[model samples]
Target: MMNILLLYISPGKTTEKISKALSDRFEADGHRVTRLNIGKPGSRTFKEVGSSIFYDMDLIGIGNPVFHLRVMHPLTEFLDQALPYAKPRFGAFLYLTYGGISSGRALLDLSNQLKKNNIPILGGFKVWAPHFYNRVEYPDIEARKTIDEFYSRIKESGYQPLEDEKTKRLFSYQTRKVNIAYHLANVIGNLRELPIQFDQDKCRGCNRCVNECPVGALTMQKIPVRDTSKCVYCYHCAAVCPHGAVICPTEKVADMVRTNKKLIGVENPQNAVYL
Candidate 1:
C-alpha cells in the first residue's frame, strides 16, 4: 500500500477516465488517493507557468516551445516544493492523450527532477484516443489497446518505482533560450481559437460536461456558457457532450491538412515535467 497522488493534466474525458481507473485500483489495494488536476489559475498561461515553474505547464494546453520554456524554470521550482510536501510512500503519473503526443523537453526535465528529488515514480504512459486539440479523425485502435495493456502492466507490477537514466539525460540542454523562443513564435502565428459552441435545441441540460469538467468552467442551465477564465482547454466537456453539440469552432485546422498528411507527433512543452 502507498500514499499515491495520481497527478494529471488532461483535456476532457482523459482525466476522468484515468483518475477513475487509478482511484479504483489504488483504493482496492488499500492506498490513500487524491487526484489533483494541474490547472491554470486563470486563462493566463504565463501566470500559471510563472507560479509553478518546476512542475508542468504543458499538461493543460498545447503551445509553442518558446512560450513553454519561458515558464519552465519557475514551474520546476514549484514542483520541487510539491514533491517534499507529497512525501509519497509511492507515486505514479499517467498522461492521457494520443500515443505520439510527447509533452516536449519539459517531460524529460520533470522525470529527472523527480528522480533527483528522490520521489519514486512507478511509471508513466500516454493514453491514446481522440485528442481534444483535434476531433476524432481515425481512432488509433492499436494505441487504445496498448494503453489498456499498459495500465494492466502497471497493475501487475504493483507500483514498482524505478529510475530511468536515459530519460534523465534526454532533456538536459545548455541553451533552452534560443530554441524556446523560436517555438513560441511559431505557436503564436499558428494560434487559432477553438471556442466551445453549444446547440440549445439539442442540449438536454444533463450537465455531464459540467460535472465531469476537471476545471469548474461549465455550468448547466437553460444553456451552457463556458467560463473561458477558468477553462483549461481540455476537451472533456466536448467528449462527454451527449448531444454532440460541442466542437472546435470550425474545421479550419483540418481543412488545411493535405490529403496524404500524417498527423501523429509528440512534443513535451518546455515547462512540462513528465513522470
Candidate 2:
C-alpha cells in the first residue's frame, strides 16, 4: 500500500469534504492516507508544516478552494513555507473546489508551481460545491461521481497530468468575465475593517467564534470583535457560530453567488469543469 499525504486548506469546508472523500477512497483501497488541514489554528508553524510534507510519501494530494480565481491564501502560504522541505521527485495531484467561475487559473497555477519545485504532476480535478455566499446544494451526485472517477483514474494510471482540452473549452470568455468581477468584489470586500458583522442581540458571547477562528482574528471581550487585519477572510468565524451571529459581506457575497449561479447554474456535472 502507498503512503499518501492529503493536504488542503478548506475554510468553508467544501474542499474539506472532498478531501475526506478522497481519503476514504484511498484508505479503503488499502493505501495509507494522512489528511491535514493547513488552515486550522497552529497548523502552519515551520516545524509542524515540515513534519507533514518532509517525509517521502508515495503520493501527495494538494487541494484547496479557489478564491478569486486563485488558490486560497492560507494554502498558498503553507506551500510557500513548506515546499522547500518537501522531498523532490514525489508524485503530487492537485484538486480544487470552486463556486463555478472557471476554476480559472488556479489549477494551472498550482501545477506549474509544483513542477517548478520538482513535484511531478499526477493529474488534477476541479469539482463544484455550494457557493460560500448562499445556501446551495453541494457534493451532489455529479460531484461525487467526479471525485470517484478522479481517484479511479489515478489508481489505474499512476501519476499523469489530466488532459487540458476539455478544461480549456469549459473556461470560456463569459466565465473569465465573471471571474474578473469576483476578483474585484473580493478586493472591495477586504477593504472593510470588519468584513463580517456580528449581530449584537443574537450574540451570546459564547466564544465559539473566537475559538473557531483559524487566524485568531476574533476576540470575545464583551462580544465577538474581529480584527480584520489578522483575518484572512476565510469566513470560518461565520461558519462555526452556533447563534448565526456572524454576518459576512452580504451584498458582495450575494452578488458573487448570484453571478456564479446565473453563469454556471446549480448541480455538479453542469457546474464542474474538470482538467
Judged by TM-score, which candidate is best?
2
lDDT of 1: 0.48
TM-score of 1: 0.53
Score residue 116 of candidate 2 by CA lDDT: 64
Q: What local distance difference test score does each model get?
A: 0.48, 0.69
| lDDT, candidate 1, 1-275, per-residue tens | 55544554444344445555646655776765655444323422333434333243211111111112232332344566555544454454434343222333444456666667666655555444444445454324554454456557766766565557634543343235435533643353244335678888888888877766655678777878898876644455766787887765435533322111233223434122233
Q: What TM-score fits each model?
A: 0.53, 0.80
Point out where model 2 deviates above 4 Å. Answer: 88-90, 133-137, 160-194, 232-234, 249-252, 260-275
The residue-level lDDT of candidate 1 at 61 comes to: 16
Q: Model 1 off-target regions past 4 Å?
A: 1-5, 15-84, 90-96, 99-101, 112-118, 121-123, 132-167, 170-190, 220-222, 244-247, 253-275
Tens-digit per-residue lDDT, 135-172, candidate 2 = 66666787788888887776677555544454334333
lDDT score, residue 141, model 2? 82
Overall local distance difference test of candidate 2:
0.69
